[model samples]
Target chain A: GAGVSQSPRYKVAKRGQDVALRCDPISGHVSLFWYQQALGQGPEFLTYFQNEAQLDKSGLPSDRFFAERPEGSVSTLKIQRTQQEDSAVYLCASSQLVEGGEPQHFGDGTRLSIL
Target chain B: AQSVTQLDSQVPVFEEAPVELRCNYSSSVSVYLFWYVQYPNQGLQLLLKYLSGSTLVKGINGFEAEFNKSQTSFHLRKPSVHISDTAEYFCAVSLDYKLSFGAGTTVTVRA
Candidate 1:
């Protein structure tokens, strides 16, 4: 089975610009999560979605960060007015069950460089 | 909120030698402990997880970790390491649906 997949593996954006990163979770996966990974650091959670509902977004650093998963399988993390500090790799993960304690499968991630 | 700490930023060990990566976590509630490995130019993959039951949990690539409640630690260890085991190891804690991660420990295995 195919694991999670993210589009535009590398994106270079100007400061103050907007960028949207897409994620395609594995088929039939019910849970999706977004995370940010800076260089030489582990990944930090950003937001999570169960189906179409965005359950957790507390990890989002600022209001400029937004995410949506309308249909359930695919999700998009949008950053408005990107800053140099937003330069990092955006990771997406999906899992089968939440309460059952299933492991989340991660995607390759999109590396965004803000110049 | 939960937080994870990896004591060592880097651990250099000779091939076929024993290695240990220390990890400690803090949380107000019960949490799930996990160890993940990331090779160069790749995303993380779960090495093992301790949700409940035995404190000693075995993971992939001959890796294992022991969950110590009193110490608030889950340190990964391998009796004999191979060169292929050289990579970044991350310790993570999850309370409810949120996941917290440590900075990560890079293990360099020298032949």
Candidate 2:
């Protein structure tokens, strides 16, 4: 992929329903990240993956949110028992290198609406 | 711990006018600073970053940011802005490998 690609640009789920968003990072990207953006707010870090290992999950809001990049190429963000407050844009970004100075390429993101 | 604060929530400027978006950060250790822009209905795009070398970093679309270590600020500035420059701008700080972002400032360029 030329850039990070996210699936299901929009999602609407009833409360308590499970939703899964997908991300296909640029080919050969070593670092993958997930973020949550609320209305009128900046993207907040959620989790990160270097290759297949989940390096940091401290920023995950709660147990309900889980992310996995099994093959280091594509990733999935799953939210269980969604709530009204869970409505937000789920952003996925990828970097060619895992180091701090590398630039990150971001996908348009999946807008999740919990009703 | 690292945190970023964007001083302005909204900035409105006439077309072809100079504009500045203020950002400040607090950190215990040396950090990398960045500016990202987000257009309506789009994801964030990196504007510029200050990694190690220069304090003044130039980015795409004629946007530039200066890293001031003494003040702990990385403010984005443009000598002249167009209506296309209207977007939400975010300042970020990275310590180690984790990145922290500011609330964001919205730039609206008017005719």
Residue pairs in candidate 1 whose N, alpha carbon or C atoms collide under 3 angstroms: none
Pick out the ten consecutive residues of candidate 1 chain B with the lowest summed lDDT.
B92-101
Instruction: List model 2 lDDT by residue over B12-51, tens digit each.
Output: 9999999999999999889999899999888899999899
> What i-RMS does every model get?
1.3, 1.0
Badly placed stretches (over 4 Å) of model 2 are none
Q: Worst ten-residue run, lDDT, model 2 chain A?
A: A96-105
> lDDT of each structure?
0.93, 0.93
lDDT of 2 by residue, A1-115 (tens): 5899999999999999999999999999999999999999999999999999999999889999999999878999999999999999999999989777788889999999999
Residue-level lDDT of model 1, residues B9-40, one tens digit each, is 99999999999999999988789999999888
Docking class of 1: medium
Q: What is the DockQ (computed on Cα atoms) for candidate 1?
A: 0.65
